[model samples]
Structures are given as structure tokens and as C-alpha cells.
Target: MASLSLPQVDFRAAAAEGAADARLREAVRNNTLRKQEGREARWTELPDAQALRELAARIKQHTLENLDYYLRQLVDAVRRNGGVVHFAADAEQARQIVLEIAQQTGCRRIIKSKSMATEEIELTPHLERAGLDVVETDLGEFIIQVSHDRPSHLVAPIIHKDRRSIARVFSEYFHAPYNDDPPALTQQARLFLRDKFRRSEMGITGGNFLVAQTGQVCVVENEGNARQSLTTPRVLVSLVGIEKLVPRMSDLAVMVKLLARSSTGQIMTVYTNIFGSPRQNGERDGPQEFHLILLDNGRSQILGDPEYREVLRCIRCGACLNVCPVFRSIGGHAYNSVYPGPIGALLSPLMFGLERYKDLPQATSLCGACGEACPVKIDIPRLLISLRRDMVNRRLSGKLERLIYRLWAWGLQSRFLYRVIGALQRWDLRRRADADGWIARLPKLAAGWTAQRDMPAAARRSFHNIWKDRH
Candidate 1:
């Protein structure tokens, strides 16, 4: 198999061109709105939604505060259950550990469930580099894998692609008959991946929640593909973020209730599999070996930061993505990270670097919809603002922006300067206004704002001036 290039982070280019496609915009808009409606309908049906949310948040906060205790307990529990646990401080170590496991097991072909953790580590490329064929079993993930594209949404990876686009991709890649029917497309993928599953020596997946009390990993998915990936193979490898741990099995109830409803708006996902360990003595079907890797990959740093620790409380429900106006307009690709949307804007910068992902914080409209929609009640807008402040404090912002802000602050501090500036703005507006009283073009720094939009000219007279005269 040929090696495929994974997506790179180029927010500037993606925002400029990748998001300009009308079809892509329409598809994202339509799909996200549908999910939002479904979420609203299902969310309203719950009697104590707010209470559940608060409970979930508190549970997460408690777990995070004592993460070390829970993680050690979790490791001991997994070992007692005859499962192996590995801790990776970064992505390189995580990938190397998985590779070592595969080589030791002599596993060649691998089947992977939908795992953002794996994506974060670029696992597929690493495995493929070692001459292993790794297949993504989820339908959405499969589409993205075959098309050589990154996921545009968390729950629905290929939400940006319409049926026609998928059909085209299938026809071109698989040489299958040209059909836009949903079931047909699904069947085609099923038939293609069945052989891979049967031949796969190992199955890789991401855990939704790690139950520390039972040492069990809970995976939630709408499709049975994850089940097949974990069970059909001889070895099962689960890669989970360190933040996914919950205190007890009973706590899963609150998370499970909020997760499904907030994500796809289902009463419950099709499969919520919990695996404590490999196949037991009496078990008929299960992996012979179970390996759980707890990945830190910048999460520990984020956890240490008081202001951003709330970000780890995310359930990966994608509700925030569905409600974010910026996400709706530009889609996930614009963020250019494994995670996208409001949560992505917060997580990517913290996980990666503030300097590299500076634009992510600026992408929001500060509408607070993401915070309102979050099942765990993370204040996403507050985090975005905090990140912006950090940028300014670090002097990461450009000189021009600093100068402009300083000038505006100075003008506001002096009443005479404020009035003079206002008068100058009115004079400029009068000079620049066209017949329609619109500024079609702006000079220098402000030109970018008017590139795709018209700026309304200022009012003919200031309200203060008119009020003063009338009095």
C-alpha cells in the first residue's frame, strides 16, 4: 500500500481557500443544523438536563483534581484483570510503544475503530510506514481514509461530504458502480472492509471513558464496527487520553446519558461496550491480549494550567461544534487539527502552542453558544478570551495590532482626543462614501475586512453633536 500524507495545520490557507467552496459550506451548514435540531429535541425531553450537566461537570472536576490517584488505581486494576497498561508522555513515545507491541505480536494488518487519539498521534501513517495495512472501519472514517482527507467533524467525520461527493469518491477509488444511495454506499464499504477485519491481527480503538473503579474501558459508537474491530482480532489495543477517566462505573450513567443525547441526539448509541480485560477462561469471543495505553500528549500541561483545566472535561460529544457559528461557517478543516470547533479552538492552542494556533482563539464571535450547548458546561468563550489575553501578555501579537490598540486606549482616556478622533472618522466616512453610502474599499490595515464585505459609512452627524445642538 502507498503511504498517504496526513493533513497539516495551515489555518490561514484553509480559511482562505479550503473553506471557500460553496458545496462544502452548504453541506456543513445543513448537517450541523440537522444535528442541532435533533440535539435540541432530545435535550428538551430530559427532565433534569441542567442538573445532569452540573453533576457531570462536578464528577469530571473531582476526577481531574485527583487524577494521579485514579490513574494509579486504574493501572493496578487493569493489571489485576490481566491487562497491560502503558503511559506515554508524548505522541512519539505512544507510537513507538504501539509499534513495539505489533512487532512483538507479529501483527501485520490492523483494523482501527474511530479514535481521535490515534489521529492525534498520526497512528495510521506510522503503521503504514512499517508496512502494515491499517483500515478505518467506521463508515465516516473509512470515507475519509479512502479519500485521503482529515475528519471535518468529531462525531460525523465526513459531515462535509454529500452523497454525490461520496459516490464519486467510491466510484473513482473502488471502481464500484456509480450510486448515490446511502445504503448502497454503506454496503460497498462493508463488503470492502469485511476481509480486512477477518485478516487483521490487531484492533485499535479509543476509549470514551475509563472506569477507574472497575478498570474497564467504555467505548460508545453508533456502528458495530468498533465492536468488530476490538473483538474479531487476536490482540486489542486501546489508546485513551489520560483525561478520560471517571471515578466509578456508576458515574458512567451520567456521562452516558449526556453523551448520546448531546452528540447524535440518540437515546443511546448503538453500542456501549465495556472491556475489563482480554478474553477470560470462559469467554467464547474476545481478544487474547489487551493493551491499554494512557497518552499524555500535552494533556498533562493543560491539566496543570488552572485557567484551561476545564477543557479536559470535554466528552467529545461535538455539541459545541454543532452550535458554533464560526464552526458552521468554515467547518473543521479551517482549524486544521484532529479536534475542531469551539473545543478545538481551545484544545489545539493549549495542546500545540499558543503562537502556532493564535488565529484559533480569534475565530470565535464570542456568542457563548458553545458554552450553552456543552453537556459538561465548559465556559468555552471564557477560555478563548483567556487565550487571547495570554497572547497579548506574551507579546505574541504583531506590532501593528498593539499599536492600534494602544492608540484606541489613549483616545478613550482623553475626552478631547476621543471627540477629535470621532470627528476625523466622520470626515473620513464622508470622503470615502460612494453614491450608496458604502465603503467598497478600505486602505491598508482595514482592507482585509472589506475584501469580502461592504462597510457602511458612518452617520452624517454624530448623535452627541446633534443632541448638543438641540439642547
Candidate 2:
């Protein structure tokens, strides 16, 4: 490992570039989002948007409902198309499979693209530990990789670091005498990576969607690196999340239309490749062998939970992060998960289990901006509420916290219980009341809430209490 200037999480952050790209997009999003909001404001005006959303929702719902059947069908189709499929239950198993493949093919160098599934598993460090030279090819991913920084955004991993910081990274890493300039820094990486791509023995990528009907694997990338990686390498491997399968190629048309547009406001990326097997009979350039690793690191457990199945439809467009005020302020690092922002808050717990990040679901203001920004129209806020319910049901919340909710529920059960507590609090609250309707200081347990903002002096009188007396 290189002793770099960036945060420890930065390395992990860039591996999932879209989550990182969020940093760069946040400001620009403010101006552009207004137009998107205007366009979406007239959502009723564009009935087609709702119609497309319904179609997408139904398509994903159907796939999730019959997950087993679709996964098996996808595997069979890929195998029949002359591609190999490997199933990994967790990160260790996935890494081992990749390691074994790398060792088998005797690969020394590899080029990779932006893949959050790979990051959630923390596969890159494992590969590096296995002593393989892994290179990130996406511009943002590459910058973060070289600088040893985490991604602050979902779509642009190196968004937090502007050209000046990136130029310093290149200068330090490559000894390329240069100043802060985007084109100069990009060209430096370009020239440096060209040789690495040409010499790499294997290339690893993530799939956008797997079509079971035609056995086609779709990859959407902005740079030409994905094509170069697949074509230049002797062996090509795609590490696809199990949930990425689409029942048929026709379904891909709809998703493709919405994917890049929603993510970057572009109609489509610079490259969109869909090829099942390697180069057919006499094709010029493509991998000699193709392998697909279907990973299930807790996706199956989530599928059975009725409240959250629709979350699987996320295309990783990052529109939610762009619109989220919280994401804009503290950024992705605070969440401390590979998937950050609105989607991360919901998906991380379900995939990794809720106990570790129980506080994350509550990290929202219940703004619903995420749901509004979503391209596939994932009801993120609804899913977030479901997660909160799960947390309560599991009793994972702290004892004091649980006690408060229980007390509130009990109080709501009857008017008498509420009045008694209200009277006691009103009398006690007056001693500490400030003209501005705030109690600046509070008890120990309540400090967390008041530490950040002023808490209204326990409302002088309960609304219902006053209303009942006047009425």
C-alpha cells in the first residue's frame, strides 16, 4: 500500500465511482436540477414518464418475484452462449474465485471499471494482497486510485478533489512535472494507462444488466477503457450482482434509455456494449474467454422481505444523491459505507444487515427528494420507513430510545396519559424557557439532539391541551 495524502475511506470510495462522482455533480446539480425539477414538476404533463415508470416497476417486480427462476435462466443462457458463470456467496468466496482465475490464466496486470458491487465486497484490496497489479480505468476512479482517496459522490468518485489536487497526485505518482489543469492531468493518465491496458492479461468489469432471453451482457461506460479492457485482454471476467438480471433483451431498451440520462443528464454514454460471447467466428477484437460471476452477498435475504423488494431496481444513476440536501452538506464519507447518499442509507443495511448501521436509516429528514429524483422511480423514502420499522421490530434500537417510543405509543393510546405527562413537562419546562422557544441545554441523554440545534422549549402548552380547553 502507498502512503497517500487522502483519507483512508477514499481508496474504498473510488472503487465505486458513481458514489464518488457525486462530489463533482453536487454543485452543477443545483443549476441543472432546477430544470429537471421543472420537467418533473410537470410530471402530470408528461404522462409518459409515469407510464415508463410503471413499466419499469412491473419489469423489476416480475424479475424479483421470480428471482430464482430468472437467475438460473440467466446462468443457463450465458453458459449456452459460450460464457462461464460462477456463483459466490460472499466477498471471500468471490475474491477467491477471481484470485483462482487470475492465477489460472497467469495474469499479471488487470484493468477495471466503476463497480459498487465490487467495492461493497472490498475486492480490490484483496486482489492487491494477492499480488496482482489492478488498475482503475474510469477517469474519476483512476484519479482516486492514484491519489489514495475515497469517493465523495456516487457517480463521480473523485468529485471532492478538483484539478489542483488531482494534478498533485499525478505529479507525486508519475513524477510528471505539471500544474493544476484538467486536460494536462487527463492526458498524463491517458498516456500512462495506455501501456497498462495494452499489456494487461485479464480485465475485470461489472455488468449493468444480464439479459436471460438473448444471453447478452450490457456494460455502459463513458470512456473507451471498458472496450479496450475487454478486447485487449486474453480473458474477460464480469462481476455482476445477482439482482442485475433482466428477463429479456427487449427490457434493456427501456433501462438503457433511462440509465445515463438520469445519472448524468446525457441521452447515452460514449459507449454501450452488449455482446454475449466473445468475438464470434471472425470478429476482430474481443476477449478469447468470457466469465460471469453472479454474486449473492445477502441479496436473497432481502428478496423475501416484502417491504423492500423494489430497491433492487436502482440503476445507480445517483439522481437521489444530487437532490439530497444532507448528501450535499456532509457528503458521502459520513455514511461510512460503500453505497452512500439516499440509496446507500436504504440498501447498505439490507445487504449488510441492519445492526451495524442502525443509525443510518434515521439519518434522513424524510424529505422524499430521493424518491422524486429516482429515475426508475424507486420509492426510497418508503423503503427507508420500512427499514426503520425493521429496526424497531428487531429491537436493535437502544434501551432509552425504545423506552421513549414505547412511552409515546402508550401516550397515544389514551388522552389521559398524554395530559398527565404534558402538565408535568409544561410546569418543569417553564423554568428553562427562553423567549425564542428553546431550551439550550438539556439532560445527558437528550444532549445529542440539542448539541446540533436549538430544541424548542418543550412547547409552552400542548396544542391538543389548549384546543380542548378553548373548545
Q: Evaluated with lDDT, which candidate comes out highest? A: 1
Candidate 2 lands at a TM-score of 0.88
Residue range 206-321, candidate 2, lDDT tens digits: 88888978777788988989888778898888898888888987898878877776676666788998866766788888888888898888777777777787888887878787
In angstroms, how far off is 254's CA in candidate 2?
A: 0.6
lDDT of 1 by residue, 250-354 (tens): 898889989989999888999999996999999998899999999999999989988889899999999999988788788888887888999999988899888
Error of 2 at 285 (Å): 0.9
lDDT of 1 at 441: 88
Candidate achieving the largest TM-score: 1
Off by over 4 Å in 1: 1-10, 469-471
Note the Cα lDDT for every prediction shown: 0.90, 0.77
Task: Write out the backbone clash pairs for model 1.
Answer: none
Q: What is the lDDT of candidate 1?
A: 0.90
The C-alpha local distance difference test score for the whole of candidate 2 amounts to: 0.77
